[model samples]
Target: MNSDFLKYQAQTTPHPLAMEISYANGSYIYDSNNKAYLDFVAGISATPLGHNHPKVISAIKKQLDKYMHVMVYGEYIQKPAVELTKLLAKNLPSSLEKTYLVNSGTEAIEGALKLAKRATGRSEVISANKAYHGNTMGSMSIMGFEERKQAFRPLLPNVKFISFNNESDLKHITKKTACVILETIQGGAGFIVPSNNYLQKVQKRCNEVGALFILDEIQPGIGRTGKLFGFENYNCIPDILVTGKGLGGGMPIGAFTASSKLMDLLQDNPKLGHITTFGGHPVIAASALATLKEVTESNLMQEALEKEQLFRKLLVHPLITEIRGKGLMLAIITPSSDTANSLILKCQEAGLILFWLLFEPKAVRITPPLTISNDEIIKGCEIIIDLLDEIQQQ
Candidate 1:
């Protein structure tokens, strides 16, 4: 099976953590060998309620029995999509009321960028350095890191980058700018959190210049950061809000929200401006709606903060330099890239699942499922600490 996987599956990386999965439940995944590996990465923060969650699975099953994709998005009055969007609007600020559902985060980013350009009649877009929006042409164009994007050059033009959290760089966002997109908490950049009201200041500058303020909450939103949206924690609201990952529970989905007046622009200027066939597929939307309901109705959001404290309190070691981020969205910064690699690999071998952040070589990702228990938290942290101690001794 391993050989077949390597030969048949096109991989993103040369070496993949090829775990042959038998099944997963709650906070643990069972490999084909029946080895129970404690899940700490949560499929890179996609499975907030954990794998095969009852509610999400039931929603998917129920929707499958009823219907799937009836028609392209916006043409059909699908219940799942309608309910999901309405719930999202109910939770978000009044300005961000209407949502455009899409196939993935990158596609949502593309739509948001197009909308910004349509609304402002401007071409320039600004992003933060070390920021990662997505991998599509437009999103990649605004990706702050040049190394990953340079190969895919000749991307969208007139896109600029500014140093994140650097107040002086706000000068770059001029009246010609269409939108300034940033992650509510920069995920790939070692889970860096905005400080000193930096996001609020950015919004202020974008308002002053008439450019839309867009926040990509793909990694930090959806109850992962002790709030429905990470922007709520920072006392800032964006003109355009993008979300994915945990919003669909373990399913694949993405959405971009803005004012009805702004989103309506996609209709008139050019009829059928943006269209997607399976953007709001019924099964996926059902799963997302269930996930959102569980996250909002349950105490999961508040418990995320408590779980973060437990992780911090337990994961104390000399080799660990710092833990950056808030709530379940966290990265353990090791002293060196080699140490980070060693820690993740060793933890995997020791029946614990840990991963690494993109662009941040020295950072080990620890974004586990929000439903992970306290005992599971202690157990995972012990494995991490034990591995760190072993690495330190070497």
Candidate 2:
């Protein structure tokens, strides 16, 4: 099966983890050999309630019995899509009343960028130095990192990069800028939080310059950070709120939301700014609705803090320099990238699943499911610490 996967499937990496998954439940995944691995990454923080959650599975089953993909996006009055959008509006700030559902985070980013340009009638876009919106052209254009993107040159034009959490760079967001986009928590960049009222200062600058503020909450959305969205923690609201990754539970979904007046721009000007075939698939919407219900209704979000403390207490080691992040989205910083990789490999061998950060090589990502048990947290962290200790002796 491993050989077949390597031969058949298109891989992003040459050496992929070829564990043949048989089944998954809660915070654990079982391989074909019935080996249970405690998951800490949660499919890159997409599974809000963990794998094959009862609510999510049940919602999917119920939706399967009903209709699926009956109409194109925004063309039909799909009940699940409409209801989900309405529910999101009810929870979000009143200005973010309109929602444009898309296939993935990158698509929503493209839509939002186009909408920003159309609404403000400007072309220049600004994003953070380590931002990871998505892999698409527009998102890649605003990504700030040139090493990975230099090969895919000539992306979108008039895009500039500014240092993340640096208030001094707020001046770059000027009247000529169409929009300023940023990850509320800077996911790929070590989950770095804004410091010293950085986001507030950026928001003020954008307002003064008439540039729209787009907060990409793809990784931190869906109550991963003890809030519905990471931007809420900072007190400033974004003109455009982009979400994906965790929004669909285990399914694929993305959306960019804004005021009705701002969102209406996508309808005119070019007469259909952005369009996608499977943006609002009914089954995905059903799963997302179920996930949102669980995250918002239950005490799962608040319990995240307790779970985080448990992880911190157990993940102690001289190799672990610091634990950077809030709620379940944490990164354990090791002495070096080699040490981080060794610890992850050793931990996986010890029946614990761990993963890496995209840019922060020395930081191992530890964003588990928000519904992970205290026992599970302790179990995973113990494995990590034990492995760190073993590797330190080497």
Kindly list the per-residue Cα lDDT of model 2 for residues 170-266, writing each as its tens digit. 8788999999999999878888988787888888999999999999999989998889998888879999999998999989999999999998887
lDDT values, one for every candidate: 0.93, 0.89
Worst ten in a row by lDDT for model 1: 67-76
| Steric clash count of candidate 2 | 0
Please list all clashing residue pairs in model 1, or write none if there are none.
Answer: none
Score residue 301 of candidate 1 by CA lDDT: 99
Off by over 4 Å in 1: none
Residue 47 CA displacement from its true place in model 1, Å: 0.7
Per-residue alpha-carbon lDDT of model 1 for 1-394, expressed as tens digits?
Answer: 9999999989999999999999999999999999999999998889999998998999999999998877888987999999999999999889999999998898999999999999999999999899899998889998989999888889998989898899999999999999999999999999989999999999999999999999999999899999999999997899999998888898888999999999999998698888899998899999999999999999999999999999999988999899999999999999999999999999999999999899999999999999999999999899999889899989
Q: Candidate 2: what lDDT? A: 0.89
